[model samples]
Target: MKYFFFMLAAAPLSVCCQTLVHAQVISKSTQQAIPFATVGLVKQNNGTTTDEIGSFKIQCRSIEDSIIISAVGFKTARVAVSVVLSARKIELEENLVLLEEVSISWRNKAKPTTLNDFVHCPTNYYSVGLGTYRQVAQRFLAPRASMRLQSIRLCKMAGKATFRVRVYAMDSITGMPSTDLLSKELLINSSDKNVYIDLQENIVLPDRDFFIAVEWLFISSNEFRVKAKIDRQKISYSNYAPRLSFKKLTGIPTQNNCRMLNFNGSWQKPENYDSNHVFMIAAELGSQ
Candidate 1:
């Protein structure tokens, strides 16, 4: 399905009446909060994410809709919307498993250089979505059989809040983002117009291709409300701040450059993804 994004706000519309629910997600064993956990409606395409404290607020169209709470290293929790409203605290079981080891031997060659698909940066900025936990991923090709990722650079056209960064391995079968490449959370709090993230330690990039994704956190500080119409229905939805910059270019396929991950926990090619436009996110790589 095509998601909505706007460069300019249109005339405000009346907000649609919907059930606003609040809840918290926590680990079942430790009772600690699970931040940024995805809370999606079962069978419904809409949802939101928890804040750093594991708290979340989502507007529901129907109380009968079931809610799915999921995060990495945890078993997905599915509860009825009605139940969630009453419980307010959802517990997800930990599902920890060891990841297969990937060994890379890099040859000392040349100094690190920036790698990007875009030719130049433009003033054009794209709103990935107005929803929480909206993620935009860009694919990058490995220059050699193995390389060390030094850092990432993202041109923030706008925003001053916390956001999460993730690295993923390309799915051999589907060529989509599949598995997490990093072990720990890569959360960054920045109000800078230009965002640069230096990895504490360089991580090995697979010989093939990889992906870098930016996940918008659903926090009070990043709250952005806008009035818009969906499916001929008027409603106000929350869009996050720190808009990622984009520019127009040709020849590069949209699917190969960018993809979107909604609160529903699925990565898809956004209809707004045009081959002529690419997100201005780049990676720095060097030989080990």
Candidate 2:
């Protein structure tokens, strides 16, 4: 993605027949209005930039289209167009820290005994790889409470191949895994090789822990599968951690059958981690 620095100016009058919504995008920390922020209708691709006051008016063809607001040095925001038209004004809180450059090292060259052993509570572990594509999955549990899976980090394995990555989420209690709560397909190319897919869910679980899974495919071909799973364990005061596992399944490994290389471990959330919060660090692979 290209990043540009610009200031927004005054708002223009609404055009006829189009539905208009007013919005203001601001930096969460500086509290200063961000101008020239990109605000557009996701479905229709019609958008406008914020003025110097960090305010912009977007005109959409219909209420079904969603309004996506984005700015440099800020996290992207999306909301239903109908809601914005009804409310007249929407405010977005931006995340100051974007992705930082880091290095990755691979280890534990052995295969996994069982996939079940890969399941652990969610902590703060991050993984990266590349091939034809990528995928990620996570499970959060709070039997009586509800939570949201906010952001995820993904990148290509250097010197390897680049591929498309897809993500999916489901309820662990359901007998059939085909019932997906959400699914998004992504294109990872040379220009935008490393991508971060953020998930926002408002669903409430029957309890604290749930399952999340992500699968990466070779574009439209499912010749190989690279998957990740995280089991989230609830502690106290809304604090939780993840047990992380990374696996790679290749068609040629088991005579064209899928074979997995698994890494098993757990991660700990720092005392001050929040939903929009992110911590950057490096990873070193260890031999089994």
Candidate 3:
């Protein structure tokens, strides 16, 4: 299966349709605008993200359709379509939680270990859709002893689009992405095929499974219009560039090799997703 992605511009915008409702997302405490927040309806499989000024226009299908709004560093908010249309501003409370301190003894190890190294293969990558925060992630089992993350590496398909990197610890019970690992934003803008990102500071990786994901930023600089046929109808939409590289391999476990998409601000494993096309994202860990 192939993946395609589209980007929404960061601007005060409006949709011409009468069913579309315009709203703004803001912080409850400071009343500050929260940009790039995703607003979506799961059942309808429809959504849009807030623009630079924290404004967004989403199509309301029915009065009962629930809208889910989510952004990094904020608590997810859910409201019915009728409620969001009636209100001028949607306030999301900040989700502020201190990270647990992970202590690991670096016993003066010499070399750093690299995980998920990819072989030189044909160009194969994945993409996200329009008005969505699609995060492609790869999970790796942490070493028995905790280690420090040195850098992350990936292959860019094309263009020089800037993207964000996120780290999440694997949930013990559910085996899904759980706690946020990297608090600070890690943005990379590069056109080269091979990209390497250094953490700069030491980040402790707990002795559990962890996930590294790439988030697409829907801004003007990364936007490009593309024509595609959906349902046999040719449509034009904004495409985000610099997709992550992938390699096809056989006999991989169903759970080990799959892509996760963020719908309504939640990471979900979409059905019928290709499990053989593994993303070429790797992490380097060391005892520093």
lDDT of 3 by residue, 162-227 (tens): 777778887777667877778555756677777777666667888547888887765566666667
Least well predicted 10-residue stretch by lDDT in candidate 1: 8-17
TM-score rank, highest first?
Answer: 3, 1, 2
TM-score of 3: 0.78
Give the TM-score (vs. native) of candidate 2.
Answer: 0.28
| Backbone atom clashes (below 3 Å) for every candidate | 2, 39, 1
Candidate 2 yields a Cα-based lDDT of: 0.37
TM match of model 1 to true structure: 0.78
Candidate 1, lDDT over the whole model? 0.70
Q: Write the per-residue lDDT of candidate 2 for residues 69-136, one digit (tens) a residue.
A: 65534566778877876765556675534422122212232221111222222233333221111223
Per-candidate RMSD vs. true structure? 6.1, 18.5, 5.9
Residue 223 C-alpha lDDT in model 1: 68
lDDT of 2 at 41: 61
Local distance difference test values of all predictions, in order: 0.70, 0.37, 0.68
The residue ranges of model 3 lying beyond 4 angstroms of the native Cα positions read 1-18, 97-111, 119-122, 131-133, 228-237, 250-255
